[model samples]
Target: MSTVTLQEKKSYRIMGISLPLFGLITVGVLTATYMEVLPKGMIGAFALMMVLGLILNEVGNHLPIVKDYLGGGSIVIIFGSAALVTYNVLPESAVEIMSNFMRGEGFLDFYIAALITGSILGMNRELLIKASVRYLPAILGGVAVALGLVGLVGAIIGYGAKEAILYIGVPIMGGGMGAGAVPLAQIFGSSLGVDSGEMLSVMVPAVALGNAVAIVVAGLLDRLGKTKPNLTGNGELMELENKKAEAKEEVEEKEEKTAINFPMMGRGLLLAVSFFTLGSIIGKFLPQVHSYAWMIISVAVVKALNILPREYETGAFQWFQFVMTNLTGVLLIGIGVAFTNLQQVIDAFTIQYVLLVAVTIIGCVIGSGIIGKFVGFYPIESSITAGLCMANMGGTGDVAVLSASDRMKLMPFAQISSRIGGAFMLILASTLLRFFI
Candidate 1:
């Protein structure tokens, strides 16, 4: 190893000391604020949560074994924040404010809007078309296997085959909160003559737990790819043969379009929000479909039809990069504090509970990986996008799992799993529940 420079060593020492000092000071401030000695409000709550998320993320990113196997700080920011709230380290008021910012203030929606708009628009038209068609079967395979395996595991664990598939499997395999569990609860509740609230109470935990497990498994898969490089595409979701003759001119043409300027970024932002709004308006009219789904369709049509100019696509990609790099920590913190419930997860601590969820995730990976190979995708890439993405917590989970696997460029595929795959879940649930009930 190269010897460290004195300046670098000094910087490291400073960081080592400053981080702990900052922690003690932050604790003092939080305690005073909790007691009403320091002023408390949204500002403090957001700032503190951001700080915690970033710090936790940094620590998780660098922790030796964790960075390799558990997706580092992405998982940490979430479960760690939940732990703070559960242990009363985070005061209820602060947690509530953070929750409101995420849900009531719509931060999660904001992040998803930007990500979906940018990713879909930025894709190569031909590649997008080729990928989307092949991707669906991979997603279906994941869903089928995940539900089947969870049911089998549940039976062995005495969780019952029907209950396992109906409650644990569907919920865990469902998209995520608003799009996944909420609608599923309504469908199942109506069929079973039980209240929606009761169904949600049963479903939410499975979704949360499944999301957590998916993220961790993604990290493990990343490590596996590193140790055995042949199994992965290394960010290319499709198969490639570097030694063969290829379409060099097409790549050059795509590269030429990637010019950047401030005005272009602004245009990109406007286009993104406008597309998101169009989806929202459509969603208002079509209550059955999620806005993101509509947005994906609208953008995909525009891309496939070559309606948008090349410059605008580049702009969207640049804008997405900026937002993902800067605001990801903030969004993750919000998910942990607002969306995760420590008590609920804790209450779900049973062998059957954990085993069933594990089986669901494994089923997703296996089903998607196998199907993806036949459809001309790399097995690992297919599993991540088609399987784990379906098993995750919708949009936010998409970001977390993709980040963990170091494949943020696969956002479009990830969104498909969340939006379209989630839609498929609703349809399947509606049909299956009738038989089960």
Candidate 2:
């Protein structure tokens, strides 16, 4: 008999048989409903099903349900499946009814937005250590200028052609490009007596689509960076040394711990949640300011005040990043399916969307690449760094991209430089775009 390891079990859970059960059930129910073969209350049924699915996931985490099926992918499948069913099965009348109910419940965009902002803010710590004040300021200033100019363009065009303002600007700015993307869309939908949820449905998918694409692009760039050697610089070395020292101290502290009295996970979650909530409330009051940008700024301000610990519990940042991004993704897909006309989506598939996407991506790559070269970064290093900037405009995606890519070459300076670029642009450009637009 063969011995089974935990890793093998995880792999089996991810692929072997259980995955199909969830996928089939979700897709089958959705497709049947869309075909009008299912009962009228299919949407409601699915909604309840989603709750059950989430509960199952949480339970599975503590117990062993379908082996490894209770992990992240399980919840996503449950939520996404219900959304697909509702979108497909329901007519416009039904969709409007459901969307109205959801809208009335009040979306948690503020909290979600703030969490995203906090993650971005947290990513900038590496920048303060690497770049000189002089050049860093200049780079940030450029980003601010870019954001303002883009925002102005969005505003000018938004008055006449709102769709263009959204689909075009959001992806270019950093996926959730404009400060006003969600709010303006909501406001406009409300004033026109349209269901704001429908618009949000559209916006969420667009954001998710952009994020998925950005991840792939970042991954490709990371792979390219690995082929080169000069990926880091002198600044990186110093930063690494400091990190090692800190790690050593942390190890010693852990060894000294004989009692387990600390509420480690609970405290970390509370602090993160509190900061996120406070930041979001502040964001709602600031019209035309990008929520994420404001959130990042708020976190930075709080950090500067020295209120929270330098680091919270283990994997807190990772959890925050994953939850925020995944939630954003699922929400977008649900919105897309619910509000968009599936037939129209098929018809609307044009070369234009693809062309726009391509040009935007190319612009990001070339622009970042040029800047990196000027800073004396090697070709591979510059390419990856530029790729990070182009894809994220400085968010969690940027951090992930750089961290993964930098490890291949250990190009610490290049890594920091790219991070700084991303941070500066995400905060400055995305936020400022609202004013001009």
Candidate 3:
């Protein structure tokens, strides 16, 4: 009986059940809604995301060619699902339901908040302090190189260096939506005598395209690290001789009754949420800086002061693992369905335009990796934070890129790139727009 039970567990019928059930349920819900009373609320939205997410992700991760060059299942789920809506492959009612749920219902914000809290609290206190000091230079390096390379590509393709930098490159390399393009549209409007809406129309495409490319490149980078063997710390940002120290810590841990319990996970969740709340509260008072920046600051201070004990920290780590393991897929689908517009990417497609954006992302990776190595950080880790984060769509982009790279623990650096590095681009845009104009 036990042998039979084990065999059943390993059967394809049991293992592959999730994908089929997801499809059947999603179709049933959407069809039922169309036929009669609509399941047109949060429940319906979640249903679509889960079904679509599970199916696309399974293919992306399992397919040999796609898992390699296309940046694994996460990217597949995001862009493929996005293409479905963009091309109108999905029903109007289905699209509307998903869009309303993702955008109107605050799904993205909730996901980001959870991600930020857990990643920050889960980091090593000493490592966090060390990494924060040097990560900024890498971000600046990415920005500088991206601008230069993109401008050069533009000139070579007859796009003109100055025109390319102002219209094409700047927006792609800018921080993100709220912090990047929205304000940049205003800057272009006032300084270059272009309509803000027109500038925004140009900028949003660049942002979305660049973000998509960044996620793909990150997967490629992870593969590159596996091949090169010396470029990454696996997931660690530093290559310090901490092995002995880690071993000693492990020995110390064994002496104590330190096992991960549910209470610990709960405490971690509470701590993470509390910090997120603090950042939000601070954002209301000081609207200039993003809530994430404040949250990082608060968490860093708490870690620095040794206010939190080892037990709480462990709980936070466990909770973080749980959240990441479960929700990364769901959120990626939300980004694709709700946030991305495949139509814009398709419309903006041109050889010269594509080359400019491609070089811009490459420049970011090369610039940040080299600078990060020089400043005592892992090259792959640095690029993921400084380059990929800079190129992605602010917070949402940060999560997607990081998830694709399989390095969610690096969320602090990613946020720094999106928030602080993004702010720097705003300043650079103001200064450079005049020269271009």
Best by TM-score: 1
TM-score of 3: 0.64
Position 360, candidate 3: lDDT:
88
Which pairs clash inside model 3? none
What are the per-residue Cα lDDT tens digits for candidate 2 across 144-240?
A: 3333343444355442223433444343433242222344344445334576545544444334334344445655655655554354332132224
Task: Please list the C-alpha lDDT of all candidates, in the order they appear.
Answer: 0.74, 0.42, 0.71
Q: Which ten residues in a row have the lowest lDDT in candidate 2?
A: 249-258
How high is each candidate's TM-score? 0.67, 0.54, 0.64
**RMSD for each of the candidates:** 7.0, 9.4, 7.4
How many collisions per candidate? 0, 13, 0
* lDDT for model 3: 0.71
Query: What value of lDDT does candidate 1 attain over all alpha carbons?
Result: 0.74
Predicted structure with the largest lDDT when compared to the true one: 1
Per-residue lDDT of model 3, residues 232-316, tens digit only: 9888776666433443332111212356699988888788778878987996897444555566567667766778887887776
